[model samples]
Target chain A: MSAAATLIAAALGIAAASVLALVSFPARSVLVVAVNALLGLPPVVIGLVFYLLLSHSGPLGWLDLLFSPAAMVAAQAALAAPIICALVHRSLERSWAEFGPPLRILGASRLRALPVLLGMNRRAIATAILAGFGRCLSEVGAVLMVGGNIAGHTRSLTTSVVLQTSMGNLETALLLGLVLVGVSVAVSAGGIALGGARL
Target chain B: MRKLSLSLAVLLALGGAAQAESIVLASTTSVDNSGLLAKILPVFTKATGIEVKVIAQGTGQALATAAHGDADLVLVHDPDAEAKFIAEGHGILKREIAWNDFLFVGPKSDPAGIAGTHDAVAALAAISSKHAAFVTRGDTSGTDAAEKRLWKKAGINPAGADWYRDIGGGMGAALNAAAAMNAMVFTDRGTWLSFQNKRDLVALVEGDASFINRYDVIQLNPVLHPNVKIEPARKLAEWLAGPDGQREIGAVAQGGEQLFHPDADKVYVPGT
Candidate 1:
């Protein structure tokens, strides 16, 4: 669930960061600060808000996405997107400052320069995706609230660890916790390999 | 992988959430943590072709979810809150499916000497006077509601007392906290029996009539929300109250001890 959800957040974050880099909107600064600030949004609050939105009586209740892996993915994506956006936007904005005026002089539109700038900042974008994936992998509150933590269906590694710890199987819980850390380590190593270790 | 994209598609589709195949049941941690639902839910699903997705939380939270029309049914143990739910027209087709006793467990040393006490009220007063370290669920769970009632009856408030620790967690978490502090607390026998971190906490007071924990099943009202899967919900309620359901519930045991007593045979009706 985390991998798949992180991928969706990556797509969204990359797009948002590219827009923030290429466009010169009046509210760009406010949105940039907002994205950076929202990196700390509590997963539980996101879960609760989504829970209400997907509730049977809520406006989006017709979607019937609550208490499923899909809802959890949505919550995870909401959490990871801001991190990806903030981190990637930092790199994109830096490179855009250096390349923007020259590219515009050469008759390239902001829309056309988007892909060029994104490609130039590949390492930063990759690091941002890794950070986003880490956030998704570690979060428990949001998924627990929205996913319902159904054993086989929506129970992810972190939620299972929590359930085990609360169940008093501290040994098993610790083992699962180690496995979670191991997954993060393995994924981080993979990210460094693919993106280089400049971060 | 299929449910992944399907979930997104449904979200974007903004269409009616497909069919009435599976139902979401809001339940308590005791039911889920005890492994009871893990055993019987699949069986129930097989027999009825209706999958039940359980959201294991406290009774208060579960009731809140059902009140918001988020759950199709509720399998909870707090009768007072269940009564309030029904009175508020949030529930119907209520049935008493099982029973267990909540235990006052503390360090085996019996810090407040509450051991072997049949009167739970007197034991609370004793614990209060002795300033025994007590951990409360404090999360408005079923056990918390019962504990609050017992404190009210004992006419002593331990709210500000340092010996009182409100962990504000589920049954298992509260038990773990109590065990760590050697604090006395109330817990359902199901969770206590299944819990592995006993450390030195033992049942100090039990078998009191006040400690009886009755588990009930209530399906959400379909009239309030036309989209509710009331048919499957009603089927689940009847199954739990029926012979086969009771047998399945009774068959669930841990550590060679039965955790819950199936009491669907003794169903409760209003007034009489």
Candidate 2:
């Protein structure tokens, strides 16, 4: 339950951050530095921020989503956003530098040139997504805090590994660790296929 | 963008209703690590057909979770925190479900020579004087609070002592660190009994009257979380205070040692 939710969260976060990075690339100098700094936002800090936000007395307490899978999703997304944004922004900047002059010479507007630039660097974006997804998969601190690690409800692979290890269920922890490795392999393999399969 | 948000909304709605027949119980790791919940909750489910999903954390974190409106009920061992939870109107009431005691475990060599002493304070003092290795769980947990109280009573501040190691983790991790360092650790009887890897550690001091540990179950106030499963939460709390629950708890043993004694009838009122 938590694994799937985190994946969704990572995807959504990556998409949003990547879009903003791509669209605002040429216009904002300060945002570039800010995005770079945000790449180091520790997972635990992200979890704490979300915990404060989703707590009963928090501003978004009306949503009442704490300890739910949705909250875990939100936490993972927050944790992954900065990494995706910074990396995708850097990759998009490089592509723009490489393709900008020729595209402009061909009378391609910035709006029309954006998709071509994205296509030119599809592999880098795919790799960035894979790295962001890996970050989401291995994250334990943030998701554990926000999701509450409830059994059959919000427990994810990483949290389950921690729980099982602490409960003296070493074999169960090892098993879950293996499952995490397998899932990562599958996701990265699929990412490789998608990256190579298209423009 | 529209499709993504729409799917996310559907997923959240589905997750909310996924466990309608179940209730989320946030309890301490001591109880779960003892394997008592596995022994007792199944019987409750069989009788009531209401599945109980448990999230085992420290007492402080468990109460925090309940206060956040994420948990339907909480089973924890910190009385002061539990009281504050109720005083803040987060919970209905606190019911004592079971009781245990804390024990000091250390290297079997007994380097501090505090073994066989029934006084934890004296044992702590002796350990401090000797500068013997000691491991502490410093995560603001119930066990951590108890250790702090003992340290205060002993009039000793071993925080920066080279012999003292404070690892901010759960009970199991503390025990593991104790075993690895062959140091002294204060632990609940439940986790101590169920722990499989002892290494060079042994229970050095016990039987302190001040070491009594009590467990309580508190149902969150329905008004605080309108969507909480109050009916099942109340049912589970009542059942735990009743005969079958007590019997199952008492029946669970580790290495021929009973981990907890049920005293709900004597100490806790069921419905209040």
Candidate 3:
């Protein structure tokens, strides 16, 4: 879930961040603010919305993704995209000031400079995507709401831990919780290593 | 980056499409959480070579999933919902696979003095009159449906009452919450038997005919849901009600006592 959702979120987030940094639209600041505000949206609410959408009765029910891992990936990606977008936008805005004028002087279009900007801030963008990965790795509310937490199917480390805890297997739950923490910690370390210590 | 995304997407599609021939079974938490499936599902798969992917949810949601064609079949315990589902042509077969009874599990204090009572309705009324803390699984699960029926029998709404607690979660969650606050909770015997966190809770009421939990295995209607894997699901339903499956179900014991009494042979009517 973390890997797939993070990758998908990275693609969408980077595109959104490029628009925010490159474009001079009237509501650009509003969109930036909106993406930032979306970070405050509880994962549970996002999960519920996706649940309604992916349910057999929902509009997108024809996809037949409900109670499937694909549905979970979609929910997790939706949950992580905003976080990646906002953080990448913050980093892109800083570097765009440096890259924008030079690229414009070189007779480059905003779309053409998109790849150049992405290459220049690859480390920081990697950092933002990893942050989104960690969020997806640890998120249970949205995953459970959409995944149905099916045994041997949609069950994940976090949802299983929640199950064990409710089953009064606190010792097992604690061990699983440690695994989750350890994994996220490892992801953070990997992000730093890949980002070359860039934030 | 494009190569990476493509591979990841392929990996995800593979993950989701694992064992494509498998049948999805939507069941109640009580059946799955009781650890009975762990003992029998492997054997069932080995005998049939058809995988059954079990997704445990509330009976309400389980049936709803099958109705939506998201699930091929359901193994659940709510008669009212099952009847409605059959009436609506969402499912067919409806063979009784196992049976258990609901137990009034509450704090050992016996605040309402319901221990040893066989009359669930009276016990509930006493609990309501005394205003004892009663935790309810308001998530529309099988046990929650039974609790509602009991409350109605006792002529008490208990909706806005201070003593009533609606946890709106699964059976395990409701039991955990009940254990936390030392509140009374009505739960199926299978879950109650496997529950390890006794804490201050005890069985307050039992042996009521009204609390009998009959689990039925229903196949998705082939006529209505032409997309369902009806053949494999039907084979599974038959195997569950067959001699071998019934033996396995009845043999599953928790705390040195059988959790479920197999009722498949005793009562299964065709085309009902």
Clash count, one per candidate: 0, 0, 0
lDDT of each: 0.87, 0.82, 0.85
RMSD values, in order shown: 2.9, 3.1, 2.4
Q: Would candidate 3 be rated incorrect, acceptable, medium or high by CAPRI criteria? A: medium
**Candidate achieving higher DockQ, 2 or 3:** 3
Fraction of true interface contacts that also occur in model 1:
0.47
TM-score of 3: 0.93
lDDT of 3 by residue, B90-173 (tens): 876788999989999999889999899999888988998899999999988888898899889888899988889988888888
The residue-by-residue lDDT of candidate 2 on A23-72, one tens digit each, is 65564777677777877888899999999998867888667677778788
- Candidate with best TM-score: 1
lDDT value, residue B236 of candidate 1 = 92
Give the Å shift of residue B203 in candidate 3.
1.5
Off by over 4 Å in 1: A197-199, B1-20, B266-272
Best lDDT among the predictions, by candidate number: 1
Across all models, the iRMS values in order are: 5.2, 2.8, 2.8
Question: What DockQ was computed for model 2?
Answer: 0.44
Instruction: Indicate whether candidate 1 or candidate 2 has the larger lDDT.
Output: 1
Q: lDDT tens digits, residues B1-272, model 1? A: 34445545654542233244988889999988988888888889999899888889999999998887888899998879988988887886689999888989999999899898889899999999999999999988888999999999889888989999999899999989999999998999999999999999998999888999989998777788667789899999898889888899899999999988889866555545
Residue-level lDDT of model 2, residues B226-263, one tens digit each, is 87789999999989988888888889899999999997
Pick by TM-score: 1 or 2, better one: 1
